[model samples]
Target: MPLLILGLLVWSVPHLFKRLAPEMRAGLGDKFKGVVALLVVAGVVLMVIGYRGAEVVPLWYPPSWTMHLTDLLMLFAVALFGLGNSKSRLRGRLRHPMLLGVITWAVGHLLVNGDLASVVLFGGMLIWAVLSIFAINAREPEWERWQGGSVAGDIRLGVITVVVYAAIAGIHYWIGPSPFPM
Candidate 1:
């Protein structure tokens, strides 16, 4: 749990830093760019390990039906993440697809895993998503118009998202403990 908390702090702080302290981020980018990259990688690795380790503790059991719902939500989250990186109509409509993705992911996990660690991890992410969105809106007063791109790009992004989601779902079933273990 301590490791999990540390990982969450590490993951959230760096992300929040960019939103809360843009000047500091810029200075660090200029001064300790390489160190920053190393730290970021280390933080992500820790977060992954912490999350996986924490999953061992079953704090609460969700009904079997909820797992299906979680899967669907995760798929949508992946699609949102994909749209975030593309010039799709969904991106323009969402305005903040990346943040939406984080929220969806966090919420989806929270519904299925009711353990203390899961709550802490997913709740922290949810808080970060909300705060980061607020910070971004506050920092950037001017609304930038969404980029217009070819429909082909949108199709490509959609296909990629579906493929990646399917791959992950398959991997989860094959190598990981059943996420919907009854």
Candidate 2:
């Protein structure tokens, strides 16, 4: 639980700092580009280790079906993540693809993991996603229609995301405990 909380704080604070504090972000960006990268990487590593370590204690078990549903939702979450990085129609439609991706990932995990630690981690992420979205929308000016890539590019990104999602799902059991019972 401590680990999970710490990881959440580490992960969310740096991300939010940039969003909420532009001056600090700019100063850091200018003064310590390498340091920022190191901090981000270290923070992510700690978060992953802490999250996996904390999962050992199950606060509660969700219905068996939720795992399957989570798997499906994760596909969309990953796809949104990939699409968020690409200049696709999806990005054009959703001004903030990364926020949408974070929302999807957080919500998906929340459905599958019922433990207190998982709740805190995913819940924090969900809240951050919502707040970040609102902040971006409030700060940025409304722009005209997005200049989406060619239809072919959209198709390519969709295919790539699906493949990446499938590969991750296929390897998940090898990386961690199987979410579904055999």
Candidate 3:
């Protein structure tokens, strides 16, 4: 738990620093990017180790039906993630597709995982994404939507979304706790 909290802080603080302390971040210049990258990697390692070793303190048992909703949410989350990087017309409509995807992913995980570690991990990420969105919006209120997206881009996005989502599911199944509902 301590490690988990520490990892969350390490992961989130660096992300929030630039937004919260623009002058400080600017002072560091481009060199800080490497440091931030290292910190993020370390944070991820700590989080994985902490979460796996943490005592499983069950909070509430989610119903089997919630898995369906989780699956649906995950599918949408994947699509949202793809929309963020794709040149699709829909990409322009959203201001923060990646953060929205993170929020969706966290919510989906929270629906099926009702434990202390799970909450700390997923809920923390959810808070981080929401905070990032707020910080970005506060910094820049005006949003300039993307332009020149074509139908081919939308088709590409759809294909990639499906492939990535399937790959994620496959990885989950290969590792532990199969994502598919029993």
Candidate 2 residue pairs in backbone clash: none
Q: Superposing all C-alpha atoms, what RMSD in Å does each candidate have to the true structure?
A: 2.2, 2.2, 0.9
RMSD of 2: 2.2
Taking the tens digit of each residue's C-alpha lDDT, what string does model 1 give over 8-35?
7777777778888889788776666666
lDDT of 2 by residue, 20-119 (tens): 8877778665666666667667766877777777745678887878888887788788778887667566667767776787898888888888877778
Task: Give all candidates' CA lDDT scores.
Answer: 0.80, 0.76, 0.94
Off by over 4 Å in 2: 55-57, 141-145, 179-181
The lDDT-based order of candidates, best leading, equals: 3, 1, 2
Ranking by TM-score: 3, 1, 2
Regions of model 3 farther than 4 Å from truth? none
Greater TM-score among 1 and 3 belongs to 3
- Cα lDDT tens digits, model 3, 1-182, are 99999999999999999999999999999999999999999899999889988999999999999899998899889999889889898999999999999999999999999999999999999999999999999998999988878999999998998899999999999988888887
Number of clashes in every candidate structure? 0, 0, 0
- Candidate number with greatest TM-score: 3
Regions of model 1 farther than 4 Å from truth: 55-58, 179-182
Reference-based TM-score, model 1: 0.87
Error of 2 at 155 (Å): 1.4
Task: Compare the candidates by lDDT and give the number of the best one.
Answer: 3
What 10-residue stretch in candidate 3 is worst by lDDT?
173-182
